[model samples]
Target chain A: MALPLVIDIAIGQLRRRKRQSIVSIMGVALGVGFFIAVASLMQGFQQYFVSQVIDIAPHIVIKDEFRTPAVQPAVAAFAEGAVAVRGVKPRDEIRGIRDARGKLAALEAVPGLAAAPTLRGPVILRYGARDHSVALVGVEPERERRVTNIEKDMIAGRLEDLRATANGVILGIGAADRLGAGVGDIITAVSPRGVAVTMKVVGLFSTGLTALDQGEGYALLKTVQILQQRPNVVNSIRIRLADITQAEPLARVIEARFGYRTESWEETNSNILSLFIIQNAIMYSVTGAILLVAAFGIYNIISTVVHEKTRDIAILKSLGFTEGDIARIFSVQGFVVGAIGAALGCLLGWALIEMLAAIRFDFNNPVLRGQRGFIMSRSALPFIFAGGFALVSASAASILPARRAARLNPVDIVRGAA
Target chain B: MSAPPLLEARGVTRILPGEGFGAPPVRLVEDIDLTVGAGEFVAITGPSGSGKSSLLYLLGLLDRPSAGAVLIDGEDTGALSAPALARLRLARLGFVFQFHFLLPEFTTLENVMIPMRRLGRHPQDEIRERARAILASLGLQDAERKLPEQLSGGMRQRVAVARALANDPEIVLADEPTGNLDTRNAATVFDVFARIVGEHGRSVIVVTHDLDLAARAGRRVHLVDGRIVSDGPHSPVVPQAVA
Candidate 1:
């Protein structure tokens, strides 16, 4: 019977001081909102880091480190022995060769590959009197198109025509624009060794990558080989696999044979990934400080309640309320305040997160300038955080006040003796 | 045979611990034999500093006697624990003081319901209805919702009486309950005592200076210098000797 009365009194008291209650709830809401949003952002960053591994490149890349890529066709020898190295071997690596004869044979060994080697190099070209230096890659048109989507990036002519001539080449649109040339135009190119070669532009490309489009050219490897005079040498052995997921173990096997270093896409940007984790940790710690502030506010409210209700407790004793009962009443009051504040805080915090999510605060993190800000997750519950904070804060805040209420003496209370 | 007295004191005495830098302990009150029967009203009066209030307090179980026995309902209170004494007080006794300490924040109804609710003898509705009826008997039926500050001194004292009787205590103690009232209000308050005792068959012990009010009691005992100098049946008497 008295418990309801006590709860009613608690509600009335809280209602009377609406401003204080709101302020306390706001403090808790801030903590909860910050905590949840930070957590969501951290999760988003983690997902981005992992997903970027597969999105940006192959699952695995194999290359000889501390040495420039060899200019030879070693892929056939490597692929034949690839099965002995402890994992599934898909398509074989292919050297930068012109004919595609040896590379196509390796591709046929693993029937899954619909493609073969992609050629790549650096060349200086001149067109219509003004020219610029750019990276030049040559490949078998049909096979290279199956491996990478170079045809979709064509700005002019057709990818099939890139293999039509020994002197045919393709240029990225930016590279063409820099050289003031287009399809069917002739260009003079030279390697770093000043070995001059003339090529006819059969197609132009634009991959939307500034470095690649502004500096890359494409040609048939046979023409590139004829022009570079390198019969059996290449920069790298680009392998075509059935699935990228199998590439890592396959690359490890291939690397073991050739004694080359292997890399996965995740290894490309390790520093940025680590920065996301560190930033998340710092954010959570700061949010914890905000929760501490909310706890302090709860303490203040309970302390005021203890002061205001002391004499009423004295009269309660005269009426035969036990010390324990009095303590219970006060503790109940503290809990009620905490519960209400927590509930309100949860609402406010949730609303705040929703609003922030709508705005999407799309900016880089201060510590990770490349990272996008503000990620929303259904699993990030601001309310739960607020609720846990409220319970702990209320219990802690009520302890001293409850003890004081219990210690009151009836004789002294009625007479003003204590 | 008649039942034993509700309260009996055999040479009850009280001593205060030394104060003012360890002065010697002083006997606050000393008593001989005394008995209060179940439905008997007894008033204790004294000059200031004569320890009449102190004796009343010790008898009311608010404090322990320095030496001697106070048997309440045939059990020695000294043999009981402090909490047990409190329980006994709650169950059997009520107090009205010179100042109306009727819990200022509570309404007249809430204040009167306190003891009955504390006792937990009845359901909530039963307690509330009984408190209302008791307040009505005290002529505070319409004032049940009014706070202490809203009621006059006389009305507040009457409310206190209703509250005291709410639990049906065997004895009601008042230390100048009408002390703050005017002559007319004081007469009205004292007038409630006879009517209540007659109808309810409850005991009352009052301490007061108004001889007119004192004369109305069934029995009056006087204390001077911490000793009973005169006691009679509501009749004026010359001092037989110094207390």
Candidate 2:
């Protein structure tokens, strides 16, 4: 039979059972809509969290530590024997990156890579008898700007001012408020090694992270080395790559070259990234359950249609419709319903996303500090996936019923009718 | 009998499988031999449960015979696949039942167009025109757009007749087509069958219980308990009815 005629017959039958058809279509629409909406919301928050993590820190950090302890000279000498060695007194060596300048120059030669050396130590800030303990990080202003977003986060003064002002420091706004200090205020920073330096605060900044805002400050690398009693020694090298996705591999390459412990941003935040996986699992399962329920509705309607159209099926067979033709007729019905439902579902999902975007929350948790409303990814992937899922499910749900209809015996029905 | 018969059934038998667990099967038709030539009208008449409809079904290829073979245009149909048989039916056969069996959702015209569309030998416009011509010949031109539910019983049966003739089949097999109609409608349906044979020169095999209608056909086959007892031409009770 011609396909148009088959489609005409199928559509006429669906029109005859309009209410049931509408109900089944609505079920699929709801499934697809919820799938898209939930996917958008979850992926939006995950992407936001990932961007925050990437922007707030270096893509790769090489610290002055070995991934494994150095082999003792006795163990190295007895390579073949299972020798038991007790703990021996370790050599007293200053823990700092050796030849930091040469390593930085080599890293700077690589394309699309930026590197900066920094030294960090615990210090006590004292102003007018008020004491606040903070981690003092030393940075070269020009190199630091290329490796981190600290310069962008400054609210008051430029980081370059640290080079112009002698013994200058930059404090986070939260830390400065605790010291009752502002730009140009002189504060005494007493290092753990009993070296005290009075420095002028050159800038104040805020990164919206509670830990960084309340407990960290930055100063010139020379001044920090002087206060810590370790002049010209830097302990950490921060790196930024043009492509953030290349961090883990580049970290491995750098670690192999320098023999230092390297941490990629993904490795630094692996716990949170694993939680995103669990979140995705929950999202897919919940949406898949909805689609499964919707598929049941399609099955129910098509099965009933097969039962009710038994006589028509017999008549069609007698009129020379092949089993394949009959099957196609009913299968087309399921496909049409799914297609219509998917179309409506995309619209509904877009409306839902818009509604979600308009909703504002007044709570001030640190994790959601700058967000005014829901974050939702407006991308086409969710719609395509949800629509395709519904289409496949709806078509699959119709197969058994179509097969049943095709297998009905015309002779039996005609005889029974007689 | 010079030309080959349009349809032939030789020693055809159909058995209904019994209920589970070794019950005896019932034979719906037994060792029936029949042949229908072009332009001939044959009537099968029998008492209740006499298997007249069963023989008709076997001859129409609507059911598979347990034994023997049914041939159409001298081709043995027993070895053909189901799809091939369906194609044969689409190209050369038509069927009518006691209940008209028109698709209720379709208008009378679309119902008639179904067979022609399935056969797909003609273009769509030609198929529509052919369906219209057939319905108009059956005096159903005014009722072409009406659904089956909106038509009277006789009109519905005539619409079914129009549908059967849509694909221009060589033979039409009808099982008790006028059984549900009144005497006047039955006569009208008989007249339609007469016109199909006389004007179109097509063969029609009808199953009916009405002896008066059976006598009007050129040949009559009487069945008694799944076997034909008599096969011959019948003298019409009303002489004018044969024309």
> In model 1, which regions exceed 4 Å deviation?
A1-5, A8-286, A360-373, B1-4, B8-34, B49-57, B62-70, B77-86, B102-106, B209-211, B221-243
DockQ, each predicted model: 0.20, 0.61
For residues A173-255, what per-residue lDDT tens digits would candidate 1 score against the true structure?
Answer: 78888888888888999887577888898888766556667888878776666556665555444454666666667656655
lDDT of 2 by residue, A103-153 (tens): 999999999999999999999999887899999999999999999999888
lDDT of 2: 0.90
Note the residue pairs that clash in candidate 1.
A71-A233, A71-A234, A72-A233, A72-A234
Chain B TM-score, candidates in order: 0.93, 0.94
Model 1, CA-based lDDT: 0.69
lDDT of each: 0.69, 0.90
Per-candidate alpha-carbon RMSD to the true structure: 9.5, 3.3
